[model samples]
Target chain A: MGLSLKTAVAIIEAALARGHELRLAPLTVAVLDAGGHLVALQREDNSGILRVEIASGKAWGALGMGIGSRELGERATKVPHFFNALAAASQGRLVPVAGGVLVRDASGIIGAVGISGDTSDNDEACALAGIAAAGLVGQTGARPAEA
Target chain B: MGLSLKTAVAIIEAALARGHELRLAPLTVAVLDAGGHLVALQREDNSGILRVEIASGKAWGALGMGIGSRELGERATKVPHFFNALAAASQGRLVPVAGGVLVRDASGIIGAVGISGDTSDNDEACALAGIAAAGLVGQTGARPAEA
Candidate 1:
């Protein structure tokens, strides 16, 4: 099933609230359904004009690659040229960073959340917090522990 | 000054309310600042995947051309080749149609709103209703009355 607007708004609100509690800069949040289409977006006042695109790119990249942006970032370092080309292929929508996280449920991934306006790690933390607050599992694309 | 997130959200809510009263199809609304940057956007559940981009394109065209998209449509009829080239140059962001309306106040043009998922005329009507509900002026870019 697709992500509902109500659920998307809840994620954005909780993410913003978490950012506020952490005293981060003004943040922008974008929620994208599994199809990588925008369901909702909010750009805080005084945020950069490009923040909407940036936030959406992060989540879109995660959804497109079937992995969180953190893992994408890790891969980018090993294959910089390929990632650069991928960015061009996606019309600059693929942002390999840490702030894009996938939302999961028993059925599978339903959507993703992307945040901007702080350290990438901090942004991802907020995303995870928001996902948890909404009672959804967040897949951060971290490497699994080896035996 | 730029439009605040609160004001943008209010416009979207009121526009959706209008659409609901009229029983229109699922709708998408986008608000863009004078710089043609998205401030906020929402795509209702079951709306087409491209609804967000279509809505954003309409509002972005209005902001970029400094006129509501209704006027852009009229102008496009007179210069089909030019309009086609303009659309190409804007990377498909320019949508000349009736649903895009400019938001204004005593200070001047601040932003534009675009709606989709109904007849263009009906979409424009909803946009006007929303702007009025928010206590703002709406410019439909209609032809001026001749003296």
Candidate 2:
């Protein structure tokens, strides 16, 4: 089943709360449905305008690949040349880093949540918080539920 | 005083190289002049179809505002409600996140690069790589020389 918009919002809200508690810098959060369509997006004021896109891109990548952005980053490190070339080939729509988590319900992959405006590790933490708040698991594996 | 097409291409090339090295999935890359004009675009064969638009949006936001997309992301956090409304108002053209970098030459703001397909953090890394490849600094607060 596809990720519900309501669930996506809940995830975002929960993540924001944690960010606030941590006094993390302004953050941008985006949730993409299984189909990769944007279900919800929130950009905090004082956060750079680009955070919205960054958050969305990460989530989009995760939903599209059924994996975490962190995995993509690790891969990029191995083949720097090819990854750089692909960056040019994609026309500026590929990001492979942490801070994005795939959303899953009992059935299967539902959607994804991406966070920006903090360190990569911190971004991932916020994303995990969002997923946990939704009462779902944020997992990493060879075959994640596809969007 | 603007981002030359050649430099833009080089930036994309470097970004892709990084992606492949890490075995990250396909990606899309986009570069924009300080005026937010398209300079170069690329999409890998395996990249998702939506990456193109996402990349463009991030670059556009960066170039339009003359700042790193990451900075924009922070601003969005303070005024999340307004930011959300603005995202809707922009009709998907505005991303406002950290995956985009403002390109700067000795003269000044030349262009911005945006990369998608991986994660927002990965996208930002690739964008930074492209900036370095172009022999320019991706500064947060700089106006375009041409402007």
Candidate 3:
């Protein structure tokens, strides 16, 4: 099944609420369906304009690679040139970063979530909180030390 | 406010419904935010594989130029070289055609909706119908003869 708009909004709201609870900086969140198409997005006031692009790129990269951005980041380090070519090919849509996570239902991957504005670690933590709050799975590498 | 997934879906559904009503053909509809980010897209069964890209390019061009693709098509005819340069600069993201319509709210332009899979006129008619059905404004220079 596709990611419902209601669920996408819930995920965004939960992420914002978690960020508020943790006192993280204002954040931008993007939720993309399996095809790397945006389902919903939110850019908190005062968040830099680039935040939305960064979040979208991260989520697009995660969905494109079928893995979280943290794992993609590791892979990028191993094969930088290939990823660079990919970035050009995708028109700069791929972003190998730490705050993109795969969203899954019991059936399998349904979508992904990306967050920006705070440190990558904190952004990831907030994304995880939102995914969990929505009763969906968020797949990523182990939490970083800062998170 | 940005285009929500719910509204995007409504647009797509309405377009597809109109397509069926007219018995044009299976269609593909794409919705993009003002930032030219994919909000949601659907390729109807039996629609050509390229329909998605065509729809996206139309919407992207409309959002990028702050005008409907019909107007963009007219401008392209007037300055083919400039339009060609824009296509290169945008990496083929812009399609100066007749099926893209701008989506506006009371405040201002929010995004665009594009449709493909039938004649361009029929596609634009469906897009306009979708935008209207979604409770948004759809602006184009004028209805094409066929539409």
Candidate 4:
């Protein structure tokens, strides 16, 4: 019912490769299936332990809202209380930020990719590049530069 | 990093088939990745709404303790407070019962499979058989009837 683990791992690898290419800080990337479950996760050396959790939170948030984290983040500004309650409801597994991007296949959103450790825009860029490298689409919305 | 969604689904299908072969009650099975996030889930028709949640809780508990739920269940009797706190920390996602088993490949523990909607022993047996069908191992501990 969602993206394959092989593809999910590919996305994380490609995202890490982009981080290396761009000389960004160490990053952690998490991929989640359509059910908002972790498929594959990778943390580059030196990425703090919390980065992985944060990345997972972003991906979970994107999957939960069926939108890119950027969109969710924007929505949070209008309904901070709601988002806060959601955060509590989700056991703090919600991170509405720019780094979470929906991964879409030909059918629709198969899953999501999330990145942490760099600037939010750059993290989202890495996530998008990673998804693209895997021959999938990423929903980056109105974020800034790609890389 | 985790079980592939494909393999997870395969495990559930195999478990469901086993349930039919054994003529047990309707069942719900859940597969979770190494990080304890649900990868795939299947609730047979007429299975209670709580079946999915129960399956997830069992899988989560197995993964959390790095042991089969059977063993965890045994431990829970001796140290109920610890298990209680764990359940709270996990937002009520802990079910240390016989139906939860670890999914392992040659490398190590890849994920976990959990079943509900029937007797715990029957549920664990189905989980073990399903893992075997998928060419993976299910850590059923020393629990009786299924090994």
Candidate 5:
């Protein structure tokens, strides 16, 4: 099944609760449908204005390429020159790093979540929490065939 | 001085060349002035339709906020609520994440470049090349200001 706006919003709310209970700093959360369209987004008041863009970019990248941002980050190191050129070419939508997770149902990828503000590990944790809250599997542990 | 159309074209050309040389796949490139207005855009054959929007959003966010997209990515972690609201409010124009860079002359920020198709790192590299071709510094290292 495709990711619905309802699920996306639920995921964001769960992430917010986790951050608050853990006393984490402000955060930005973004969810993109499998087709890489924005479905939901949220940023805290203390978060920088740019967070909105960053969170969206990460989720977009993950959904666009059908893989985790962490995998992209690993590949970037192997080809810095190419990666640099691509960064410029992409006009800033590509982010090759952790803190983003693909959402999966029984069928396939449904959507993605990207969080920023805390450490990468923490951000990923929040994403996972949100995924679980939405009653979907957080595909962080699954390796895409392309990866 | 604002980034001229000529400079923006130069950046796009350089980025395209790099993409071809690296065999990075079809891509889309966009250039924005310091104020986040579009100056030029190019979408390579076979690239997805959404590539144009992704690249444009990245560059627009970088140029509008006067910082690298990576910094914006970090900020999103702490304040997702506000970030998502802004993304919705921006109507797909704002993207905060690594893969876009500010174009800087000796004086100050002239514009920005954003590329998409390959990995985020590769897109960033292409933007850097375009900035260099335009005889400007690619401010990939600079972080966005805190909100």
Candidate 6:
């Protein structure tokens, strides 16, 4: 099912709340539909200016490859050249790092969320918290063994 | 003062409401800070996937040049070559059209809003309606006489 604006906003609110609770830095969050179109986004005041693009890029890359950015980060190390090419092809929107998670439902993948501002792992934690808050599943694209 | 996420969402909500009232096509709206960075954005479902980029480009161009895309469009007609070069230089982010508008407070130009997915004029109308809805002034970059 397509992600509604309400749900996207809920996810953003929850994500930011998690950041606030953890006393992390101000955050930026982006929710992208399956087609990698922005459904909703918010950049907290005083967040770095580039946070929005970086957040959206992380989610866009995850949605584009049907994998989470964490897994993509791992792969980037094995084949740096390929990941570089991918970044070029995607117009520098493929940010292969943590904080990108696939939003899933019983049907399949519905959308993705990306967060930025804190450490990659902390950002990913917020994403997962937000997804759970919205009663959806998040996949970080971890291999089954690692997961 | 900077463009707060709250004000940005208010603009998007009012813009979409205007579009719905007029029965216009699905619209995508983007809000950008004075630094030409995204503050918030939303694309209505079924709107073209490229709407996000187009909307952001429209606002980005306005903030980059300190004028609205409507004026930019006028200039593009007189200097096609210059405008073409500008497009290339911005990495294809400058979109000269009617829908981009500057958001102003009493202090000065604070940010910009862009709308896409309908005729450019209609898109601009929605942007104006939104800015007004938020109790802010919108500058379409129309010449003083035309305005």
User: Per-residue lDDT of B17-40 in model 1, one digit per residue for the tens?
Assistant: 999999999999998887888888
- Model 3, residue A88: displacement in angstroms? 5.7
Per-residue lDDT tens digits for candidate 4, residues A54-143, read 898999898887878998899889999999999999998889889999888768888888889999999999998999999988885533
Worst 10 residues of 4 chain B by lDDT: B138-147
Ranking of predictions according to DockQ = 1, 6, 3, 4, 5, 2
Which has the greatest DockQ? 1
Instruction: lDDT winner between 4 and 5, please give it.
Output: 4
Please report, in order, the local distance difference test score of every candidate based on alpha carbons. Answer: 0.88, 0.73, 0.83, 0.82, 0.75, 0.90
lDDT by residue (tens digit), candidate 2, A18-61: 99988887788998888877898888765654566667766766
Candidate 3 chain B minimal-lDDT segment of 10 residues: B138-147
Q: Can you tell me which runs of candidate 4 are displaced by over 4 Å?
A: A89-91, A142-147, B1-73, B77-86, B89-147
Q: What is the C-alpha RMSD of each candidate to the true structure, in Å?
A: 2.5, 14.2, 6.0, 7.5, 12.8, 2.4
Off by over 4 Å in 3: A1-27, A33-49, A63-66, A71-91, A107-110, A142-147, B1-56, B73-85, B103-136, B142-147
Per-residue C-alpha lDDT of model 5 across residues A36-78, encoded as one tens digit per residue? 7789899875454556666776676677567787665566566
How far does residue A22 in candidate 2 sit from its true spot (Å)? 1.1
Give the local distance difference test score of model 6: 0.90
Q: Give candidate 4's iRMS in Å, 1 decimal.
A: 9.3
- The DockQ score of candidate 6 comes to 0.71
Which whole-number lDDT from 0 to 100 does residue A31 have in model 5?
95
Global lDDT for candidate 5?
A: 0.75
Candidate 1 regions with alpha-carbon error over 4 angstroms: A142-147, B142-147
lDDT string for model 5 (B13-99, tens) is 998998888889788999987767789999999989988888988877765445577666676565443334335435567677767
Fnat of every candidate, listed in order: 0.85, 0.00, 0.00, 0.00, 0.03, 0.80
Q: Name the fnat for model 3.
A: 0.00
lDDT of 2 by residue, B70-99 (tens): 777887674343234334434556677778
Grade the docking of candidate 6. Answer: medium
lDDT of 5 at A145: 32
**What's chain A's TM-score in each predicted model?**
0.94, 0.88, 0.93, 0.92, 0.89, 0.95
Number of residue pairs clashing in candidate 5, backbone atoms closer than 3 angstroms, sequence gap of 3 or more or interchain: 59
